[model samples]
Target chain A: MSNEVQERKARIKDMVVSALEVEPEEVTETAMFVDDLGMDSLGAIDLLAALETGFGVEIDQAELPRLVNIDAVYEVVAEVAGWPLTASA
Target chain B: MNTTTLVRNPVITAWSAVSPFGIGRDAFADGLHAGRATKLALDKELWTGPDAEACLVPGFTAAGVLGKKGTRSMDRATGLAVATVGKMLDDQPRGREIATGDHAALVLGTTTGSAQSMMDFTRDSLTGEKPFFVDPSRFPNTVMNCAAGQCAIWHQLRGPNATVAGGRVAGLHALNYARRLLTSGRADTALCGAVEEYSAARSWLDRVGSGDDARVLGEGCAMVQLECGAEDPGRRALAEVRAVEFGVFTDDCGPALTACVRRALDRAGASAADVWAVSPSGTAGPGEEAALREVLGDLDAYRSPDLSLIGDTAGAASAMQITAVLAMAERDRGAAGRVALITAVDEGVVGCAVLGLA
Candidate 1:
């Protein structure tokens, strides 16, 4: 994996933990929001907003279905922001 | 009377309404008597001129109605639900579950459920860095059933409780459900009504229409206590639920609404002549107005005079119209001898309720 992807992943992890008030360990790349963190509808909304502003991407209501996990969210943000993943940032 | 007959005639023992006018029965009574319109002139500063005017409940604070602990976990919908229930329960001595032992279910109706919270979430998600920063306590309050759930929890009601949304017909639908519960002996007394919380999104939709959104933006909560049989003691037993009919009509509002009303009356074992008055779904939509004029205009007994004053209250509109019908019944006991038809339609969905004087 590229360093840019790794860095963005770390930042996303931190944002999720801080916004949801969950432990850092609770927010792994594979951790599902509803199943792993018990994030309800409000939590989902908050997390989406945080990701949008932090990564400078727009997540419309139609795109909600695609944003189920950390990787999916990161990919969308990175792709939209034109942040190509590299071995080093 | 047999259980079938008794259950068929459920009575409203107590009721309460909180609206733009103010709190309690007297305020509404005064407002109605003086024909005071609670609608506020649209605030140009807050919103554009077209969307400015709305009937908003003034001086409403969740803190005042639902104490600190209660308000902390509640959304605006639940807050209004609990407030209206509190007022209704206060009027009756048997509301105490400890005293009654039996459970009291609450059935609340609304067209736009948690839409306000959703709008807030949209704004925050679109602007904020981390969406998860949203308050944890506000999570449960975002559901459509939040208001009903909170009311059940506060009142300690363990029986069936639900929140229904069907545009203008929601209030009557809630009462209809309450009636079924009472008749089936599922609950002895049910707190039933409808509430609508106007939000920015709703306002925008109102403007998007051909500038004639019949459905007005109204924020308020109103509840009526339903009990089985005439033995119940309240003087304002605002008519009994005889029959409730729900349907959807794409076009031709005339035949559709008339058929629904006819079905309700047929189920109630009443006729047009038996109906003293008609509380048509007064959304003030051009389509509905024309349809109602055609339907009720032919009937000399079916008259409506409240929609002009109350405006359209959405989910709470049916209850508001029902309240007006009940008030009429209180004044003219003879009207009670006849059935009153309360009908509401929105977005092509039509709901009709037949209320006979209890």
Candidate 2:
């Protein structure tokens, strides 16, 4: 379970970094999509879509507001997928 | 230079439009007369729905015209361009009856030219190195200038042909270019306007990805026949382009647009008070509205926001706007109107034209 969580998180990070044209090292948990990565409204939508498709998780339009930073997005994906996620993992 | 001076006044002899609001000239005319809007249903499923409803061309096909072989090679944008020009020629007597040897030029404008083709090719190339079938013919159609080239080939317009891309200002630029060519004695007549075909692939991308942003799925072409001057005195000349001014307004468009309008009016030997009607860029924004009000003067200057029905056609928007003014020239004749100033501002570019009706 821990391994799965780590893998999924890593994949999401990779997708976000590539889609936003930012360095992988720059994608920290505290990184805000707009301020840190220079993601505009269009870029944010694209990033959200990528995260959903890459992780095979569904994100509701209403829940979009909860997805602010990298940590919140990961949490949402994990919660929706019924996976156990830990801070260490 | 003496060569740069305009020998003759360029006139829009004939014009045609194909859009979701209307399929042909008659349909477009009826729609315009009735004040009909062409906004479509935005379906999230197709990306033609809710978030962004665009004006799309209705019942478009390239069957009898291009044939199967030719159709297979061209993308949707090329298909629309070829089809629209065919209809324009067939409908307008002046456009169709022109002699084959007549030195007519072609200028086309577009933004997302061949993006659909590039997407398709990329998707296909992903499958295998030794692909099952790679159509080499589609490659040439993927070029940005393919629509202009194809139009030239179809019409046998062997003289100077060019294509321009300037986001929303493309059509105005093409018209201005045609005006320059005719004035400079490069060609007697030219087919100038914009062509764009919304691809299914583009829609698919938008549906799955492009969120919250407003973009309509639309495809069509609008073209006009421009000649040096009226061929016959009896013919009711729609409008004569007296002067055209272009300005790059990167920041505040108000002052620059005002200056350009002043320059255009000055060149046309007219003043703001002489101008009765104003056709704006009409992008459904406040900045342009403020600029128009400030530059043209008077809150009620016969403004037409027809672009709302046609969508932001980029290049076609300007030509279509001018066409509207020309269409009204016949009606405004009784009032003894001297000129109509058409203004188009896009991104950081401003295009203003003063037209004389006879």
Candidate 3:
């Protein structure tokens, strides 16, 4: 991944932390939104809105279920914002 | 035949309070004895137009008392109820044992749920970018029984859970309900109380509504543990609930209040002279006071209208007043075996409870 994608990923993590009121260290790339991070359906919507506002990107409603973890969230944002993905993915 | 009969009264095993006096029963007692006003200026963000004051529980963070988990979405009313219940349970010798049992019940009283959350959720649904994008977590706080329901869930109480809404008499209603449950052998032990939280919507409503001019708004929760018994030797009994009576009036509260007190005293088999203290509802003005004076007639009792200091806590007012009476009984050895009368006048209803200190 490019440095810009890494920076964006970091920013997205921060947004999740703020939205969920969780510690930065507690939120990991593999942490499940609902199971591990304690984000209920409402919290998930709150996170989606926060991410959209912070990144200035519009996420499709159909993509909501795809946002299961931090990595999945990053992928959706990357796809929507047209960020370049690594060939290894 | 006279209806008065000899019967075992429910004992108040433990009690706790969260008021502007601060968190616990001791703080509440100290604040009352200190005789200083507990009212503080309402937050500018909450009250944008006029400078209003309320008795808000200071530095109360539910996360601090109850931990961070399962509290992020809790409103102030629910938080106060939970925190007060937690404190009451802590005072019990086998609090954990009682809470984990299936026979322990919870009955909480509130004028309503968090008005702020209700308004905010409704406003969000109307003005949000998408019509259906309202926050889902706040939906639970909008319910009238949210506080009682949350208390049961958080404490793992699996028994009967009920929420009573009786405006200013909510505390008496909760206590009366719990007493009935205990008497009927439906529950082994019960936690009963009332809670009120200060909010922008509530403050605005009070200003516009037909509330008493003398009483200011306040917020807090007061809870007591009740069990079917005549004072147990092993347990610390604060007071014995002899009887509870309530009645509705069309115009004059004076006669209604007098009748309620007379009924309570009669059921308790006690006379007006037996009462050591009287904690009438803070909202009770000249008419109610005159009724109390007429019924009791020059009775030497400590008349502590806590509303003058802590303000009117709405649904929680009666519970807080009873708590004050209990504190006085606990502190004063002279008050032992002396009855205490707590009266609540709200809307068109008058409720009275006679408690005898053990």
Candidate 4:
């Protein structure tokens, strides 16, 4: 389960980097996508599409606010995916 | 025939182009001076149709050239237009002044924004699980005004945005429109230009329409900054916009262009004897070149190196022709303070513009 979590997190980070056009270092755990990465609304939509394809989860448009940071993104994605969330997550 | 009076003769203070030669103003000028054919095989991913060789801006990838952030969903024509405008803004000394505030306007010309994007979006809508399940981000590229709109947005230009869809004469149409914008006081600075993006869909269209006369396809964008009453003493004026005349013809553009050149020169207070350089469009009708020769009455003036090496850029042809004129006038010490003539013909529309080089 821990290994699965790590893999999923890495995959999500990669998606963030690709969709937001941010460097790996910029995709910190708590870095806000809007403030730190300059993700516009269109970029957020693109990230949503990438997230759905990456995790095979249907993300509601209403939950877009939860995508502010990397950790929050992982939590929403994990919660929707029925994955076990660790205390740190 | 509409023409801008040479009385106010707005000058082109800066210019740039993204061409098969390469990316900047110098890149294109250098390519022209080198005098080599710019044809190369396109990637199969771009086009699998026949005519393997096309003059594409070498090593161009929207995201690769313009960073991936806002360009992920951007189409090629939009990317080329944005790059051309940005290059002008970054390359020219008056860049900061020209692209400033709501006074700075942009007018881009094209046949139909991005033919590939439109085809792709339509294909996606048809092939997707459902018709309405198409990618939303790709919607903008299907519009004819997309490239112009994107350029305005990317550059934050708040002035009037116009997209001229005049086929081969589109570029000249854009220049004329920019001239009017300045003359009307609607804009203090106008960036007028044209863009063409090579694609498989465009190739198929050419094959369908052009019998055997089709020139090999090429992709590029050329832009010039026109300012009215520029106050900077040191500002570079590559040339002054003298006259832009348009005409419609049934078949032979020879008569139409002859009339256009005559009217343009007359409007600019220039005679055929004053034109020291001529940049004729490669796709010009059979008699068009003869007409220009007859009008100018001198063969040497038309001796400027033919820019056909750049390939037929369709809507961008006239703009590229203008670019070639400017590029030549820049180095030819003999051409200083002289008039250069540029002519273009497409479909039934024929147009000509005379620039008084400075």
Candidate 5:
């Protein structure tokens, strides 16, 4: 993966952690927003808005539900921001 | 009109409070007895002007007690109400049983929903790159009934949920509304309370709007559990709500308060001299006090420690004051069997409630 992609991923991770008020270690790639991070539907919407504001991307409402984990969020945000998604990063 | 004739006399089963003094009744009573001011300088980030004071609940974290899921979207006012109701239920042995049932209701009083959230959301919509980029989750918090509705949702209270908005007298209005619900059989148990949240907007408004710099702004929530009829076995009644009266006046609140107190006492079959303690709103100016004195006649009347310690809580003031009176009665053995009167006069409205030891 390129340094820019890694940096963008890191920034998105930080935004997710900050929005959820969770620890960095807790926001693992596999951690589910609802099951692990304790976010409800409303909180999920808040996370979407925060991500949009943070990344300067317009996320479709339908894509919100798919943003369940850190990996999923990174992929969707990366695609929307036109960042190349490497096989492993 | 004679309001005393329509008395139901509901019993106050359990109560709880969150104020600048602390979270519970004991903390409030201790602060009241200490008689020291609890007002503190507002955070510089919250207000832009010179140092102003406010009575904010010390060390309150909603996540500490209510966890984080349902609380993420909750504003300060809603958090206060949820916390107060949670504490009230925790104090009662059968509280869970009562709360889970469909017969339970929640009524909260507030000046408005959350001025802070409303302002923030609107500002975001207007200034953001896009017109609708604001967070949709915050929209619910902007409604006037959000606090009460959130409380019901958080506690599983499925009965009628309502919110009464007004000035300081909102507390009395909420209590009286709960009393009617219980008497009319619309609800068997009512979780009634008042809540106010301190925000830079509210502080600025209070500062510029009232022109009364001496009156410090405060925020907190006070809740009481009201049950219809007499107390059930194993449940102790803190005080019996005998009667409640409220009315508006154009200019002079003295006559209106006097009349309201007269009607409440008459409904309770008690006189002004029978009132052991009187809790008046902090906004009750000299004229209102003089009117109350004229009606109740130099009784053991006092304002809640919250008024001097925390500042005027606005909508929550009357409920906090009533909770203070109940706490006083519970702490002092001599206060038992003595009737207590709680009055809130604000925005040309006078509200009064009569209570006696059960």
Candidate 6:
């Protein structure tokens, strides 16, 4: 993976760890937020706000529920922030 | 049949305070004993408004004391209440043991949940690209009952959750509510208290609302565990809540308070001379002080209100007043089994509580 991919993942991980109150190691690419990270409805809202704040992007309200894990969040943030989605993946 | 005489007053089996001096009961006790001021220069980053100082819980942050988990959306008032409940439970094994069951209840008092949270949420909605683009997570904090609900949620208090908002008398309202809950058999163990948060919004409101009388806005939480049924001889307690009486002052606060204090003393089966300590709400005018002196005049009791030590704690003021008396009781062996009084007069309301020290 390119440095861009690593950086985006790292930044997204930081947001997840802070917003969801999960450990960095716990926010693995496939780890589900509600199932694995102990996040509930409020946590989901907080994470969505954090994404909008951290990336300086606007995410569709519908996209909040789809942000199920680190990989999902990385994709959504990259897309909303206008990063090259294909290269990020 | 006089119900007041037959009613079993719940003993405060355990109590805790997260005060301007610091967190926990011991810190508050030390500060109260010292009777020193707790006002500090406001953090410039946090506030650069008209007020330059406040009595804030030293080095307090929602995430700092409660950890990062579930704190991102927790406002200061809720955070303080949660922390105080945690400390109260941790202070006594009985509180933890009794309050963990389905019988536990919570009653929290606040001026308003957190003025800052409400203002911030409103600002977000008004400034967002779309009116609905605001963070929904903050909506909970905007409500006056949020801190009480959060305390119940955090502490697993499953019974009779309540929140009372009556300005400085909010704490008294909460204590009375808890007593009723226990008397009504709605809860076995009721954790009750009040909290206030120092913020730019609250400070601004305090200044405008209180005008000349507003002292340095102070913030903290103080909680007491009220248990029903028989008192356990093995456990230590701050006081047995003898009586809590509240009345409205249509015109004269002094006369209203004097009557309320007399009623409370009568119900508690105690006289004015029996009161070993008195913690008056510092926000009220000279009327409150004069009434207190008239009732417990020339007594050798500890008569100082806790305002100088903790500043105007707002909703937490009454609780802190009770805490001042309790803190002194903890140090003096002679204070055990003595009666202590706490009184508050806010706007149209005058209230008092008599505690039989344990």
lDDT tens digits by residue: candidate 4, B1-358: 4454443878898899999989989998888877868988778875775667789998897888898778878899999999999898999765966675688899998998888899998997797655654556778999999988988888889899999999889999999999999988899999999999988888888877886444688889999999887778877678899899999999788888899989999988898777788887867655877898778876674547567788888888888888888888787898887898888888899899999988
lDDT of 2 at B232: 73
Q: lDDT by residue for model 3 over B132-225, one digit each (tens)? A: 5655666789999999999988887778899999988999999999998887778878899899998778877777685445447788999988
**What interface RMSD does candidate 3 have?**
3.6
Q: Compare candidates 4 and 5 on lDDT and give the better one.
A: 4
Ranking according to lDDT, highest score first: 4, 6, 3, 5, 1, 2
lDDT of 5 at B129: 81
Model 3 DockQ class:
acceptable
Instruction: Spell out the clash pairs found in candidate 6.
Output: none
Residue A88 alpha-carbon offset, candidate 4, angstroms: 6.4
Q: Give the TM-score of candidate 4.
A: 0.89
Rank by TM-score (best first): 5, 6, 4, 3, 1, 2
Q: List residue ranges in candidate 4 displaced over 4 A.
A: A2-9, A28-31, A52-58, A70-89, B1-7, B130-134, B298-301
Give the range of the ten consecutive residues with the poorest summed lDDT in model 1 chain B: B94-103
Each prediction's fraction of true contacts recovered: 0.05, 0.00, 0.14, 0.24, 0.38, 0.48
The residue pairs in collision within model 2 are B20-B56, B42-B48, B42-B49, B42-B50, B43-B49, B171-B315
Docking quality of model 4: it rates as acceptable
What TM-score does candidate 6 reach? 0.90
Q: What lDDT is reached at residue B61 by model 6?
A: 92
lDDT of 5 at B196: 92
Candidate 1 matches the true fold with a TM-score of 0.73
lDDT of each: 0.71, 0.69, 0.82, 0.85, 0.81, 0.83
Give lDDT tens digits, candidate 3, residues A1-89. Answer: 67876787789888788668788998887888788888876777778877776676788878889888777888888798887764433
lDDT of 2 by residue, B1-358 (tens): 6744637678877777676665566666667766787766654564432345666675455543456534645666777777667767777555555612358788887875767788766665565333423334455766789988988888778778899886566777888898888888888778788876665555665456545366554556777778887667654556677888888876877777878888888889887677766788766266666776776666485635355666656556776777666655545554245677778777788888787765
Cα-based TM-score, every candidate = 0.73, 0.71, 0.89, 0.89, 0.91, 0.90
